[model samples]
Target: MPEPQQLEAYFALTEAVSLLQHQVEQQLRAEGGISTVQFQILMALNGAGQLTMTQLADGVVYSRSGLTYQAGLLEKAGLVTRGPSPEDERATLVAITPKGRDTVAKVLPGHIEVTRRLLYEAVPAADLRRLRDIMSRVRDHIREEPPRSAAPRRRRTS
Candidate 1:
């Protein structure tokens, strides 16, 4: 078990993340008609141009089925497209559409604003850098394990 102070910090971090994610999701829905998960997919594709389904699942830290469902919604909205990967027949590729880019562009300003207003505004200027550094380190440490995509699927029971 973690020490008392460590547990306290963990709870505080998770609660803060939950609160922040809730507000971010609301903003994304209101401003872009997109869910937070959809936004994450778009943001990743916007930055990378395209990614394999497994890659996206790992990057977004979402389950494969969940990512597929969200991708389908994005495709229906003309925001993204899914195609079989040229490099790997077994893999599917996802790419952001022009509309997706536009949606991201539309929502980015508000995203930044909300992040600044709700998070940064409450933190001391001096602690901002420290907080970022600490979080980065923690993230790196946690990611030392294999990504979710690398895990084997369990057998289905009838």
Candidate 2:
């Protein structure tokens, strides 16, 4: 286990991230009928034009099944559609519909405003830059590390 100071720092950072996520999610939910995860998936599709389900799952922090469920719901809502992949018939591709794009356009401005107010307005430009640099480095380091044996695996157990 980490020492007390290390644990405290971890807790504090985790809480901060959670709070930010919650706030953003609440704002998105209030404006759109969709959750932040759904909004993110839409945004990814809008940005990328089209993506495989696996690509969408990687773009967002969603489990494959969870993303599929969300995509199914979105499809039923007329917000997105899945089609056969052009490059690989075996793979499926997901894309945002015009309705989805319009919905995202309607909500994106408010989302950006809230993000700017919560993050940018509160920090000095230099500090924000430094923070971004530090976070990027940390993300790279973690991604480069081998999967830890002790890491929790997502599997059902009887």
Candidate 3:
């Protein structure tokens, strides 16, 4: 078993992330009438203007097929449009409609406020800075490591 301190740290971090996700989901659901996943898709399209379906999936951490379904919903809602990619007819690109842009403008302020309340209001400024630096270091370290399957073999092959 992990040490008590390590377990506590792991649970605390998990809880923090869960709480943040819940708050965002509630706010978006109530105010914007959209699921968190849908909001994420809209936000990605709003910021990028237009992106391939694969790009949208990557930007929002969804599987490509999952993004395709969400994009269909958004298209039905008249918030987005997907068209054959000009650069690659084989790929589809998604873009936010004017209505989508308006929805995003309306929701973003509340989202920012909620985020600030959850993270900034709860921590000292110095702690927040330290947290940012630590997270960046962890991310960079993970990015630097080779994939598990690519690790060097321990024994000589025949």
Best by lDDT: 1
lDDT of 2 by residue, 1-158 (tens): 88999999889878978988888898888887788889999999999888998788766857777988999999999989998999999778998999999989988988999889888898899999998998899888876754332245578899
Residue 86 lDDT in model 2? 90
Which digits, one per residue and each the tens of the lDDT, describe model 3 over residues 19-137? 99999999987888788899998988888898888777655766655778889999998999999998898889899999999888888888999999998899999999999998899
Model 3 poorest 10 in a row by lDDT: 145-154
Give the range of the ten consecutive residues with the poorest summed lDDT in model 1: 142-151
The local distance difference test score of each candidate is: 0.95, 0.86, 0.85
Error of 2 at 29 (Å): 1.0
Error of 1 at 61 (Å): 0.5
Best by TM-score: 1
Please list the residue runs of candidate 1 whose C-alpha ends up more than 4 Å from where it truly belongs after superposition. none
**Considering lDDT, which of the candidate structures 1 and 2 is the better prediction for this target?**
1
RMSD of each: 1.0, 3.3, 6.3
lDDT of 2: 0.86
Local accuracy of candidate 1 as per-residue lDDT tens digits, 1-158: 89999999999999999999999999999999999999999999999989999999999999988999999999999999999999999999999999999999999999999999999999998899999999999989988989988989888999
Q: If scored against the real structure, what TM-score would every candidate get?
A: 0.96, 0.86, 0.82
TM-score of candidate 1 relative to the true fold:
0.96
Those runs of model 3 whose alpha carbons end farther than 4 Å from true positions after fitting are: 139-158
